[model samples]
Target: MFKKRSLWISILVVTLIIACSTSSSSVPKLRDKHHQPFSSESIWNMPIGADAQYSGAGLGQAKRFSPEINYYIVTQETDPQVPWYFPQNWGVGRCELGGRQLGKIHVRADLIVPDATENKTPNNAAAFLAPDGETLIQLNPLTRCEKGGPVFGHPTPREENIYGMGITGGQGGSGLSSIGGTIRLGELLPSAPPIPHVLKLLVYAHQYLYREPPGYRWPAVRSDAYAYKDDSPLRYGGSNPKLVMGALLAIPPEMREDDLGLQTLPGKKLFHALQDYGGYIVDDTAWDNYAIALESGAETEFELTYGYSFGKNSGPFYEDINQLFRALSIVDNNTPETLGGGGTPRQPLAPPIGN
Candidate 1:
């Protein structure tokens, strides 16, 4: 009798498990807002920072924002010049006056080519070779704002640019690669949340610190694993979208969970800042660690309002966010090597030395 009862209970439990998985499989697509079967490649399956390491060995000093956190202030400035790869009017609507917030970032712009109608050579036509030497990826008509088609999922090849749901801005793990500027207190009436909403991302042209992009192959890197003359990683600095994505994935899931992670007041606030407010990635190398964009008279406004509330470190914001991420292992974007296990990074084995 006892054996029969156990057998029946086991069968019922298996049935319930199958039912639950089948029912919750459909997720809404951002493009049509219609429910679609979750594909094997969905971004949901990909880990955060699915691209590259979060921290690099060459970024130099780390800033401690709290007792438990330390960060690299990658870039902070007002009115910096945009990178050459970015499209004109890239942030026209997205980074407009009222839209400064987290996940807000700049991106590489489409190149303008010479129209056959005109006699002269096109201004900024550049050649981009694919990872396979034989295929040349066309950059003449590369798009900054053009919406992409549905992304099958994350871990999409760097070669095929298509990302999730076809929405250009939201799906690409590229956006999460870097953080951007937002309204500061006493600077043109701050926004409601006081910062841009989380997940909005941006990237401007700059250099990366490493000589070689460690994680994976890049379009411009040579067969010898060195950068081409026109795209030397060392001379131009560096930015690896993959590295940033990988770092995001390394963040503890518990940190995101209200019930399991982040229970303390500061921990909760910091988690919200990272998960919602957003954090910056050292996508490209720059003169100073922080590079904030200034246009639309923002630079002048910041200068004029200096004595007021918006000066550095005066607002409620924490200057160095990398500190909050210290709970995870420090990922060295500059190093191609991996530790802890395969491509996946494991929890830090020991407390940070010299802490």
Candidate 2:
């Protein structure tokens, strides 16, 4: 009788375990209204790849090294009378909008992914205008600078008086004042590869051939890929259809993936940018490479008081401004792969026949 009782208990326990496992796996992963899966990959600041090509020397240059993802282009115009916001619920992280009215591109809901959710805001509308007066581009949620979003909505200067003002101190979105987020290369700073500086001024100097010093460069490039073109005019650089949403960029091989620390004010602001939302590859063209848009109001500001410079009057000198670009690349946001596989394996469709 004791042996029989033990046998029954064991069977009962096994049955319970199997039932629990089945119940958990049976729960479907959340999908947005469009039947699109709520992808963890869309999450902001999630590390996607380890290294990519940044050389602008060649034309029709497809990114030689990067993860495969879908890219989309949506046409939209801004309404000067009404304010717009981006739909936050939908996981759509990348896209381009052209045909701006009133110097701004107002994006509507239908333009967003069908799966996107109605986020913290009602319809999730947002306007994007490249400082170079191109069109609107939204990559990752964290990399954007909405009017009243979590980070700076307008151009904000770093207050030297404040001690702990991380990356949140910058104006927030795409602008000369806006600084790009930093990445960590191995334990040391030198081991990392070169990153882009999406700040407006640096891009302006590069685009206009302002005859500046070595501004921003991808560490692996053999030559200064951003050399000014003596022949090209001040045309819009942020115009490219190849750059799409959900693309994963390769990080520098030597990057210290574990050391994304906030060591400086700009670094802190960048940290906040990624912490809040993620960065996405918005536009990629010969004219402009990696135009990461920040909040707004990148007009003009002083560096001694703010740590960044803008406008003609904002004097840190052209050379000094270039230094800031170099400084921006030296970030160590030891970011991690937030969306990669690390979950329960799915059960086989059928159970094996036992002897």
**Candidate achieving the largest TM-score:** 1
The true-versus-predicted C-alpha distance at residue 282 of model 1, in Å, is 7.8
The local distance difference test score of each candidate is 0.27, 0.27
Task: Write the residue-wise lDDT of candidate 2 on 1-355 in tens digits.
Answer: 9999999999999999999999999976442211111113322212323222221221121111111112122243442223323323323331222212122233333332323333321111122333333232333232233332221012223321111111222221121111222221120122222222112211222332214433222211111233334465532233222212222222222333234432344433333323222243222222332223322222121233354442222232332222222222211222232231112211111121121
Error of 2 at 239 (Å): 17
Candidate 1 residue lDDT tens string, 209-317: 2234342232112112222244643243344443332232233334543343443333344344343323333222212232221212333454464332212433323
Q: Per-residue error at 88 for model 2, in Å?
A: 28
C-alpha positional error of residue 246 in candidate 2 after TM-score superposition, expressed in Å: 13
Judged by whole-model lDDT over C-alpha atoms, candidate 2 comes out at: 0.27
